[model samples]
Target: MFSKSKCFVGGQIWSQTTRRITKWLKEVKSSTIRETQLQPTCSSPVYCYGPLLHTVQTAEPKLFKDSKTFVDMRMIHSQSETLDTFNKLMEKTEGKPSHEELKQFVNKNFESGNELENATLSDWKENPKFLEKIKDPVLRQFASDLNQIWPGLARQIRPHVIENPTQYSIEPVPNKFVVPGGRFMEPYYWDSYWIISGLLICEMPDTARGVIENFLWFVEKYGFVPNGGRVYYAERSQPPLLASMVDLYIKYTNDTKWLKDNIDTLEKELKYWLNVHTVDVNGNTLLRYYAPSAGPRPESYREDLETAKGNQALYTELKSGAESGWDFSSRWFADTDGSLNSIQVTNIVPVDLNAFYCGAVEHISNFYSILGNDKKSAEWKNIRDEFRESIYKVLWSEEDGIWFDVNITTGEKRKQFYPSNVSPLWTKCIGQNQNMVEVGDRVAKYVSQSDMFYYPGGIPTSSNRAGEQWDFPNAWPPLQGIMVEGLANSESQMAQQLSFNLTERWVRSNLRGFRDTNEMFEKYDCEVPGRYGGGGEYVVQSGFGWTNGVILEMLNAHGDELTADED
Candidate 1:
């Protein structure tokens, strides 16, 4: 039912593209999912988003703290047998099970901790040269500890998972990779970009290459990377970073043969984004975060059901918000009420998403040039040029002095102070005619005027204190990386200093959090240094992959200059 619509951009007719709509249920109803019965097929609705999943997630008093605990657990019996037993149990309990009953059922029916095995990276070095660069003794020791965390975070899928994939939600990949740790036992999509960067910094190119190879496998099989390594995530992707990961991999390893071997898979990943996620804004093409899947996410099932309250549109929007990796953020909401019900993620084109795509394509072009394929290089270069122009034309707010996420329906700028506004600079998504020095000055001025420097922990995700994890008080690792790296890329000295100042605050916060808890966190409260973030579906998690990566990257960039002295 998708139809292309013509776009009028600056008095010129642009190419046609499909729009994301609120018909998730309609698509699901028409999909090939089995209408009834639970089976071992990954595509079976029963396993992914049907009665069994729903019943387990919504059990009275909740047997597990996180709903994801149930879905990720391996079934001890066959799916069909498990469903049949569950049906009989439900009938015996009149379809309403107590916490104890559910606990016993789960204990008897499933086994936990069998999906992934801890992998030891053979290339892990005890002391990389980055440690020598750090002038501060305390900070250097902290960085060393973070380096040690790599072994604990590295994971590989178990043989049973590959053999009996349908018994678990985790996706089976061919190579050993790093997981984000804690309850996140599977390799995620966007998190890997930072993880890969950290791996290269640690001088583990083979480990990094293995991680990228897994992503290539995902692109070959799913036509795009899933949000994470799980069957439930098959419906959507996080931000596109596969190409950027590969680009960094090549820079570190100089593995041209590897790049030449897998360049087609990289191209296929980019095409999936271009063909599916593009939107026409006044004839200009831009990308937005989207999740075409129906039903509550298997990981956050209970919370999504409660938030959506039977509204299928909200369910789709919630899923899209998850796909944005800023799950439950005020950035995606349509209203100022600060409620999840107001989320409308599919209605807006995000600046960071487009910048990531543009940057990725630019790398693709560079990668081709490296392989001496001038024709393909020029083709992607031309596409990259067009994308940058479109971003400037459609997302740049000249008066506001920054890029903004625009609403797709009304084509209006979402003027706000999310760190993502300056993401174009990090991705080098500027227009061809723009002066780098002036752009840098303007971005620096924007940060100063926004009072983003007021926070001691790091740059807050947004100016809004909307009680969501992505709003005020909370600073994410990736957003901090985006802001610091983006501003530093500017030719203006002020921007570079601003980037360093941010690095100091962010590193100090990571150090403080690690010293306080002996663990790294997923997000931190910028307003309160050393405090982990709050107000998400689950407790703020530790063993955070990207947080460690960003910290390591900052250490690599500013280790010699960073100090632990408060003064």
Candidate 2:
């Protein structure tokens, strides 16, 4: 059974409005879990309901300080006093949403992946020209199809009316947006990075801007983008790549005004990181994936409530790991169990999280320098300098010869290899970061391996072939783009070669899959060709937004020169 949340009863009153309140609950007996794929609903207020996390904007939003529970449709302060409320409110409200209503959502008959394939909030429309006369037929056809897919994926909502600027909520974003496909009906935080890439290539710049502006609306209220564009996702964020997203957006449109206007919001996002996500670890202000509270994630309540039982504290960590977007990877697990039950995610200080922070801070520092904030630029640059050094000193595992997520409790390294190791190179902080040029050399070892990291389709989520979606055999677009671009940026020739190889293989697989299935997928099985990827929380999904985006990018970079026209 799929994980479904919110067992809610109707008619709850809040802020002088007769509203429907949702709650996430857990009632587990024996070790078995049962859930429904749910009958399809024609319309929802937000893209999704978690199976229960969907959101509709509130007219008069109330600011909440509890970061433990729901903060959707609210404002959160970036500073400590306001930040304090978020931390506290979150503690009280998490998993308080009704879980009883879930059965009502279940279909009288079972639902399948094919049933949910077209379940987006928006209808597919044609806005841009589809390529017809491209040299490589395979590349041309896939690009044309992804361009067609964007319209069906797009959504538009009204601006949030939050009572204050300090509150954060995951209400439906205030502008037009596109979801990441399949059950992901909301605009996700990190997925926007790749989606924007496809939007630019598709000549749909306006839609891309709408997506960014929608996120800016969130930054305006909550100080950072929520993990997804739903009010419920405000608890934990995805990868910190907004700076990179802005860079990509500007690269295509050169929107200076948007950057200038949002510079302050960008800085506030930095403060969100420094004030909330950062910790003074052994005198260094490094970042960590801190879950909101020691409660079950509203979306994954029953599964979490059962695993790591008798240890709610550890449960919070596990939820935080899911927030990291490498949800259910071996790196976060404690035992040999390959399932989600083995997750102990909060225990580690992720190298990628800090590496992303390194890039974000540096990107902000440079952007401010361009905006003529000299003092501010130097101040942020100093922060980046300290952070870059800390990543090397604290995160780079000398014994493993690559970065590892360090266990916070024992000060021991995770000893597991993940795509997290290549993140520093993506930030271009590898050789230049504390002059650790050898760090690139050490990382290239595993990246260069064929039977391991160098799969024919792309780098599998990681070298470990566990059943998790983020694990090996299943490779997603975000990691492919991240690893390839990071490699291209590296001074090492090996890094550049690997970048070309990664892009070529992934793009090739996308072409073959499009030819076979007439569909683009959320991920691909690296070990198989023209087949759907498997072993995630859900079935192999189609109409995937990021996969379409990154595939366009890879082909654009290497299609004519490197592609051999397998057709």
Candidate lDDT scores, in order, read 0.83, 0.63
TM-score of each: 0.91, 0.74
lDDT of 1 by residue, 1-567 (tens): 223554343233334323322221111111122213222224854457667788788887777888888878888987788888888888988988777877888899898888888898999999988889988999889889989999999888889978877688788899989999788888899999999999899888989999999989998888889888988888789999999999888888798898899999999888777766677777787777766556677788898889977666676788778888888788898864567788988888999999999999899999999999987797678778878898898898889778999988899998878998988999899988887888999888888887766699888887778888888889999999999999999878999988988898889888888888899999999988889998778888899899999999999888888888677
Expressed as tens digits, the lDDT of each residue in 167-259 for candidate 2 is 333354556778887667667988888998888777767777778888788888666777776554665678888887777777777777778
Per-candidate Cα RMSD to the true structure, in Å, reads 5.5, 13.6
Error of 2 at 286 (Å): 1.4
lDDT of 2: 0.63
| Residue 333, candidate 1: alpha-carbon lDDT | 87
In model 2, the runs with Cα more than 4 Å from the true position are 1-135, 158-170, 308-311, 335-342, 398-400, 431-439, 564-567
Clash count list over all predictions: 2, 42
